[model samples]
Target: MTQTPDETASDAGSQLLDAALMHVPFDGWSDTAFRAAIEDTGIAPAVARGLFPRGAIDLAAAFHRRGDDAMVTALQQHDLSTMRFRDQVTLAVRLRLEAVEDKEAVRRGATLFALPMHAAEGARLVWGTADRIWTALGDTSRDINWYTKRATLSGVYSSTVLYWLGDDSLEHQATWAFLDRRIGDVMQIEKTKAQLRKAPGLSSVLKRADSLLSRVKAPKSKHSNLPGGWTVPR
Candidate 1:
C-alpha cells in the first residue's frame, strides 16, 4: 500500500534525523549538519526544507519529541502499581533523561533554545514532555490542577535534565540524588498546600477559590490546538 503524504513526510523526516544524529555531536544542530544529513540520506533539498522549515531548530524539536515518545513507551511497560506517587513521578523523569542516546545533543539543543527567539519553543517542548508523563501516569486532573501539574513537573524535569547533562558521577548517581531533592521540595510545597486548605481560617476561602477554578477544564484532546480550554460561569 502506498503511504499517505503525511506518513511519507514523516518517514523522510526520520531518515534525515537519523543521519543528522551522526553529525550533531561534531557540528551541533546547525545548518551544516542538516545539509550533510541531506547529502547522506540523498533526500532532495526542497523536500528536506519542506519537512523542517526552521532547519536545525525543527530537527532539535523533533529529537526532543522522539525522546518523549520513547519515555512514554517505557512508562507503559513499567510496573508502577506498588510505588508511591512521588516515586512514580521521579521514575518518569528519570526514564525521560535515560532515553537520551547522546547528552551532547541535548546540550546543543539547550543552547539553541536558550536564545531569546527560541526560548519559548524550548519551553513548549519541555511542557509537552511533562504533559506526556502525567498523561501516561493516568492523571485525571481536569481543572486548574491540569495546568499546575504540568507546569510543576516541567520545572522538575528541566532542572533534572540540566543536572544530568553535567553529571560525571558513576552512572550519574549524583543527578538522581539531585532529582530526589527537587521532588522532595515539591512534595513539601504540596504538604503545605494541603495544610492550608484544611486550616480553619483558609478553608472557606480556598473552597470558594476551588469552585471558580473548577470551571477551568483540561483542554480536550481534539481541541488541543488552542493553548487552553475553559468555561466561564454565567
Candidate 2:
C-alpha cells in the first residue's frame, strides 16, 4: 500500500530525530561514540557532527554558563551540508539571538525553541520520556489535549532555558519565572491582535485616521488681524 504524504513525512522526520538523538550527552554518551552510532544509523559523519555541534564537555560548560555566544559558536563550527532537523532548530535559536539584544534574544530564543515542538514529532517523545512520572499519574484524555499539554509544558521548558541563557541574577528560579510571565504576556498580546483583526470597527477606525492624516496642511492658512496687525484668509 502506498503511504500517505503525512505518513511519509513523519517517517522521514522520525529517522532524522533518531539520528539526532544518537548522542545525547546526558546518557553517558561521548561525542566520538555518538558520532559512530550516527554513522552506523546511515547518517553521514558530517551530518551527525552538524546536528550535534558541541562536544559533551563544551555542551555542559555552555549549559552551566547559560551563554548564547558559546552555543552559537558551537553551532557555527558545523557545515550545513549535513544539517539535520534539530540542527536547523538550533541554528534558528542562535540566529535569533544574534539578531536581537540580550533581553529580546531570550524571548526570541524561547519562541524559536518552541517551533520544533510544533514541527518535530520527536519533541512529544522527548517530553513524554522526561515527564513520564507525571504522565503516568495524570488522567488520560483525547490525543489533542494530551499533545496540547505536552507542547505547553515544552514551551515552558524552552523558555526556562532561554532565560538561563542570559540570566545574570544570583537566583535562576527568578529568571525562569520571569520568562514564564513574559510568555504569558506574549500570548495575550497575540490573542489581542487576533481579536482586533476580527473586530468590526477596527479597520474603519484605522482608515479614518489615515484619511484625516493624509490631508495637506494648506500652508497653515496664514491669517492677519485687520487693524491690530491680524488678517484672516480671503
Candidate 3:
C-alpha cells in the first residue's frame, strides 16, 4: 500500500521521537531532547516545531501515538472477533503499554501531560487511543454511543497507565490486575446499561462509567524499587 503524505510525516516524526527518548529523562520533553534529536537526525527545527509545537508535550504525544500504532499492529496477530468485546479492550490496553520499555519515558510523559493547560490535550490523546482501540476491535458505534464508549475506555486506559507506572510485580502483574478490575467495572456497567435500556437507570450507569479507580501501589517483592534496572518481580 502506498503511504500518504500524512503517513510519511508521521513516520518521520516517530523517528525523531525515538531519538529524543534518550534525552527525555535528562533534558526532558523540551528543548534539549528536541535539539539533540534534530541535530542527530538532521530534522529542521521549523519542521520539528511544526509537528510538536508544545515542545516536550508534542514529543510525548508522538511517543503515545507510537504506542497506539504498536498496539494496533500487535492486535493484528489475534482475531479480536474471537474475543469478547471487553477482552479485546483489555488486550488493547495491555499491548499499548507493553511498547514502553523505559519507565521514565512514561513518567516523563505523564508529567508533561499533567500540566493544567495541557489537560484537554491529554484527554484528547486518550480519547484518540480509545477510538483506535474500539475501531480496531470492530466496534460499530456511530451515535452518541461512540462518545460514551471512548469516554468510558479513557478512564480505564488512563487509570491503567497510572497503575502501570508503579507496577513492580513480576511482569506488571499488579498493573494487569488493576486493569482487569477496571475492565470488569466497565463490563458490569455495560451489562447494567443493557438491562436498563428501557428504563431510566442508564443515566446513572453512564455517569458511573467514569468512576474513580483507586491508586494501585507497587508490590513489595524482595527486588526493591530499583530506579534503572526495573526487573519483572519474581
Please, what are the lDDT tens digits per residue for candidate 2 over residues 71-107?
Answer: 4455456575576533344343433333332443233
Candidate 3 lDDT, tens digit per residue, 151-209? 89999999999989888899999998899999899888878867775568575664554
Worst 10 residues of 3 by lDDT: 210-219
Clashes of each: 0, 4, 2
Clashing pairs in 3: 29-56, 170-233
> Which stretches of model 2 miss by more than 4 angstroms?
1-126, 129-137, 182-234
Best by lDDT: 1
TM-score of 1: 0.95
What local lDDT score does residue 28 receive in model 1, on the 0 to 100 scale? 93
As a whole number from 0 to 100, the lDDT of residue 39 in candidate 2 is 61
lDDT of 1 by residue, 1-234 (tens): 999999999999999999999999999999999999999999999999999999999999999999999999998899999999999999999999999999999999999899999999999999999999999999998888999999999999989988888899999999999999999999999999999999999999999998988888888883468766779778
lDDT of each: 0.94, 0.44, 0.79
Off by over 4 Å in 1: 1-4
User: What TM-score do all the candidates reach, one by one?
Assistant: 0.95, 0.29, 0.77
Whole-structure CA lDDT of model 2 = 0.44
Candidate 3 is scored at a TM of: 0.77
